[model samples]
Target: MTAQANYNYSYDLNNNIFYSGERQIPAYELEENEIGTCEKCQSTILSLSYHEIDDEFIVTGKCSICGNISANIYGHEWNWISEIFISHFFGQTPAQTTEDSELQIPEARKSLKNEDNGIDDLELLNSIPMNQIETIFSPTEIKAMFARAKGEKCVRQYLYNARKKYKTFEDVFGIKIDI
Candidate 1:
């Protein structure tokens, strides 16, 4: 009879690694002829998997000697390899930069602000990060806010029509122009 070797696998979330007992055996290490090397132990086998969550791309794996390790490329730091991987694997276009989609305020919108109140919805939206803005505003409302901030014509009428099906601009966008 022939003997067999069995092994169990454990995953580390903070540092994505596959380990048995205390020894790390990342998938890359098992490759017949891999060129990548581990930075910690200088082992020529560190398996890595790419994951794009929200706004960050995380590469996780382990080394034979280092239990768990990972690297993160976030925001605009993504290189060509990461871009291609994220686009082809995740099927998502790279996220837009903060300045790329910023709302443009027209002089007309500036003149129409309630003279009694100095609140500018556009100004407020600009101050907060996009993540926070997304939490409180729906896509449609956000689009309308951009229009209103830019002093687009007929924004009041458009908002009036939208109010019937959705929350008021003040309630959704977290800025009170009338107050």
Candidate 2:
């Protein structure tokens, strides 16, 4: 039997089937104002929307001011997660972190004022938005830094080459990058 004949494909566009990785998240279930910053202009004010393709949920936005665009992908499992938790997860982690710590930029070194939240100075430092980092380095270079942080085997050689040719992150960002 042909693969097409053996396999069954079903979609209910009439029922609004949008796959957020594994399941459908209807328009009503999408969250708004979950907080995102622009990649080009570093604006926190965004106009956002969510849609699903195959098995991925994509949230795309444009900056209200500069018109820069940014997007995020979510799997079906993420659909049920609370907005606050998603915000915290995306905020604290490097994967999709933003650089528009706009209000926090001037004092980026300061720990968050909220008491007993348990995020330390180092976490805060690492959490510095990528847009801010981009101010100091190109996107390709930043990718090298993140690759090094992720312990990729070949990153060391590339970063070593970068160090030989350019002022390293320590010199520009003012923090020692062990990786």
* Tens digit per residue, CA lDDT, model 1, 80-154: 232111000111112211232222221112322433334355544443335544665566656666676667754
lDDT of 2 by residue, 32-116 (tens): 5745655446677342456655565555444465433344556676543211101112122112222442111111333333223
Off by over 4 Å in 2: 1-31, 45-47, 79-179
Off by over 4 Å in 1: 1-117, 154-179
Among residues 3 or more apart in sequence or in different chains, the pairs in candidate 2 whose N, CA or C atoms overlap within 3 Å are 21-55, 21-56, 98-129, 99-129
Q: Rate the local accuracy (lDDT) of all candidates.
A: 0.37, 0.39
In TM-score terms, candidate 2 sits at 0.27
Q: At residue 44, what lDDT does model 2 achieve?
A: 77
What lDDT does candidate 2 reach at residue 45?
38
Model 2 error, position 161 (Å): 27
